[model samples]
Target: MNKEETFIKDLVVLTPDVFEDARGYFFEGYNKNKFSALGIAIDFVQDNQSFSQRGTLRGLHYQNPPYAQTKLVRVLQGEIMDVAVDLRKDSPTYGQHFGIKLTAENKKQLLVPQGFAHGFSVLSETAVVLYKCDQFYNKASEGGIRFDDPTLNIDWGMELKKAIVSEKDLVLPDFANCNSEF
Candidate 1:
């Protein structure tokens, strides 16, 4: 696998070496030693998957410190515009965000370290996303920032007015008002 660092510290994109032939293709999605060599050494304890139709926007979500998670996110069956925002208080890039296109064809994964919020918007008719989290989810620690926060100004690859967002997400706090503990 190859690791590409984003402008934000500790955020990286991983592309695996894919072997293909007339039959099909193969790639090692995860290998502990290979990942460790790349500086990703999280002991992922949970795997989560979500399916969303085009125009659906899911995040800017994270867990507070003491329950913060490091996530390895990838698209399983379609395409999505993945985003991550730095929330680490002491980092120079705190509050900055990074976006990337992840598709089944590209086979690229984003490694979002703890102290960041993560989310995605489906770009295909339908998309299946799989993510590994280093920490078990704690409902009490759940937190989020509004996806359309003016300060963050994320380009979710779609228009917010027409995007399919949940009622819960619709009321999430803006970046500055968010109680981030990372």
Candidate 2:
């Protein structure tokens, strides 16, 4: 596996070594020892998965303290434009965001540490995204910023008019208005 740092501190992109044969391909998605050797030592307690159609946008979401999570996210099927925004109060890259394309073909994963908000836009006909979280979910701690926040200027790689978002996400506060405690 290879780990590449993003512009935002603590946010990394991981490329796993894949083995392919005439029948198919395989790769170790996660191995505690290997990950620890790479400087990631979180004890992920939950796994989550979601499926969305093209143009669907989900997030800019994060959990507040006591429930803040570090996520290792990847596309299990199809493709998406994944994004993460640094919300760490004292980090140099705070308020900055990074976006990358993750696809089943490329098999790349994004490691989003705590103190960052994350979201993704489906780019294929249908996409299946899977992620492991270091902490459990807490409804009271849930928070989000609008995907189209002007200050963040995130490009979801799709026309705004074509994007489909949940009502909750549609009403999320913009970056400047968010009360991020991270």
Candidate 3:
């Protein structure tokens, strides 16, 4: 496995070594010791998965301090533009966002640390996303920024007017109005 740091602190892209043959391919998605060796010592406690169709957008979501989560996100099938935004008040990259194209073919994963909001837009006919969280989810701590917050100006790799977003996400606060407690 290999780890590459993103410009933002603590956020990284991890590529696992895959052994492919005539049959198929295999790679260890997670190995505690291996990750610790790479300076990522997260003890993930929950796993979440979602399925979406083309033009579907989800997130800009995060949890408050007590339930803050660090997530390892990957695409199981199809493709998506995964995004993470720094919400850490003390960090140099606060309010900045990073976006990456994650596809089943690439087998890459994004390690999103706490103090950030995450979201994705499907780019294929369909997509299945799986993510691991270091903390169990708490509804009370749920919060998010609008996906189209002008301050963030994230290019979700799709047209916002045609993007399918949930009603809750549609009403999320903008970057300036969000009460992030990171």
Candidate 4:
């Protein structure tokens, strides 16, 4: 049996079985049974995809109680430095963060368990990303910390133009103003 790897509690780095030859390569994007065997029992309820130009950053986002989400996030094309910060006030690892390079070449997925804030920065000419969420989005419960919030000190790929953010996202309260327990 292949040894599974862990990146943090409930977070993992899955190396799919890859088959390669002169015909190029092939690998399963997901194998639910394998994931289950590895102890991830997530039942993905929603799939989301986004395209961003290089230097764009999205998130540091999470939902409040009754709407928290767990995500399996990956890059399909180009590259990105993905990040997730534990926000569960009750979790032992709260306030911690993990960052990883995600690219088409690497084919890695990040498991962002509930109570983590997620974000990423495009590092290639463009990036196409996809994610599976365990819970449906609840607009009213949406919460976020600004990508440049000094307290979080996230280095979102640097001194480039401000990332294009939806107007709604632009108006979210900073961590200083947030009162959510998670």
Overall local distance difference test of candidate 3: 0.96
Model 3 lDDT per residue over 81-160, tens place: 99999999999999899999999999999999999999999999999999999999999999999999998999999999
TM-score of each: 0.98, 0.98, 0.99, 0.90
lDDT of 4: 0.79
The superposed Cα distance between candidate 1 and the true structure at residue 147, in angstroms, equals 0.6
Task: Report the error of model 1 at residue 140, Å.
Answer: 0.5
Better of 2 and 4 by lDDT: 2
| Residue lDDT tens for model 2, 97-180 | 899999999999999999999999999999999999999999999999999998899989999787999999999999988878
Whose TM-score is greatest here? Answer: 3
Q: Report lDDT (Cα) of residue 38, candidate 2.
A: 95
Regarding lDDT, does 1 or 4 come out ahead?
1
Taking the candidates one at a time, how many backbone clashes does each contain? 0, 0, 0, 0
* Candidates by lDDT, descending order: 3, 2, 1, 4
CA error at residue 8 for candidate 3, angstroms: 0.6
lDDT of 1 by residue, 102-133 (tens): 99999999999999999999999999999999
* Shift in Å, residue 18, candidate 2: 0.6
- Which regions of candidate 3 are displaced past 4 Å? none
Candidate 4 TM-score, C-alpha based: 0.90
